[model samples]
Target: MNNKAFEVLQKEAPEVSEVWQQFLLKASALDEKTQNLVYLSVLSAFHLENRIPFHVKMAKMHGATRDEVISAVLVGLPALGNIVTTALSVAIEAFDKD
Candidate 1:
């Protein structure tokens, strides 16, 4: 349900989780926003609805615009089908938060 999964994973496997975090933070060729967008696409494709808003907010913090996230969600179109149309609303609302 949210980042609770990631939190639990880190706590349960701190060493491995730290390594994976370092890999994403340092080993990735993509920028932060790009990585977040990629994560969004993958999560949406997998129908991981619970994680959507969390990643959407992270992407926005990493400099992804609303339009950019819209495009990312659409990239999962073949697998997501009509869900993309509605998921966009959640993503947009994440960015709209006060």
Candidate 2:
């Protein structure tokens, strides 16, 4: 449970965050809101709840509505409905937090 290591690394190399943003920016076909919604769906499908909040905020910032957020979270209904539902709750909490 040594979170400090990651904190230090990110502090020292904040450019990693920027690099990821830049990479994400390369997908020209999708606008920012759509991209964020896709990211939310992917994260939920992968059970990566930790990132749901960040993506939710970004989605809202990029014009995703609450209903759209819910829909995005439920993208893979047949295969991952349960997990995505949990992620939906997290997404809403995070959206409110933002």
Candidate 3:
């Protein structure tokens, strides 16, 4: 929630950020935990390691276990290979936090 890009978007383009949040809410047909898990996989696939910790925490808040977080990070390994591994440590560190 304290991400710099998100802060900038909220400060400089509040309307766009609000609309994006609305879109996410409206488009979420999957259960929250599942959606967060899917988001983790996509983040991993894209090598979005910086974003992983936030989503990993969200996933944990939604009842995702540590193993689920690990699996989500590795889910993209087949298609993306080792690039997905870059997110594993980041995701685990986030998930393991209190």
Candidate 4:
């Protein structure tokens, strides 16, 4: 079942998806309990194209502070540049569900 899932993903995005899959697997070295920050950071970076609410919920479930999540979004500013960061900020606000 999982192999089928992976095959589908690889077929859909061979190069980028493979890199992401490997990166995620490598992240396991940090331990699940302590990886919330890392996950939240990536979640923020992927916010424009990914499921923001889902990741936000996961971050909350992992005991992440709202500030921590916002900081994650802010951290993307340098790498993503101002415009992309602004787009991500909008996603963050939407995810806040407030």
Error of 1 at 2 (Å): 7.1
Residue-pair clashes, model 2: 0
Per-residue alpha-carbon lDDT of model 2 for 27-73, expressed as tens digits? 46899999999988898898888878877988999899999998889
Overlapping backbone residue pairs in candidate 4 total 0
Error of 3 at 24 (Å): 1.0
Q: Which residue runs does candidate 3 get wrong by more than 4 Å?
A: 11-19
Residue-level lDDT tens digits of model 3 in 1-98: 44798989999999999999889968889888888999999988987788888888888999999999999899888888899898988998898887
User: lDDT per prediction?
Assistant: 0.81, 0.81, 0.88, 0.61
- How much is the lDDT of residue 98 in candidate 1? 38
Q: Put down candidate 4 lDDT per residue, 30-80, tens digits, no spaces.
A: 744246556556655655434455556666676766777677667767886
Pairwise TM-score winner, candidates 1 and 4: 1
**Could you estimate the TM-score for every candidate?**
0.75, 0.79, 0.83, 0.51
TM-score of 1: 0.75
lDDT of 4: 0.61
Judged by TM-score, which candidate is best?
3
lDDT (tens digit, per residue) of candidate 1 on 23-83:
8789889888999999888876766767888888888988899889988988878865886
**Could you tell me which residue pairs clash in candidate 2?**
none
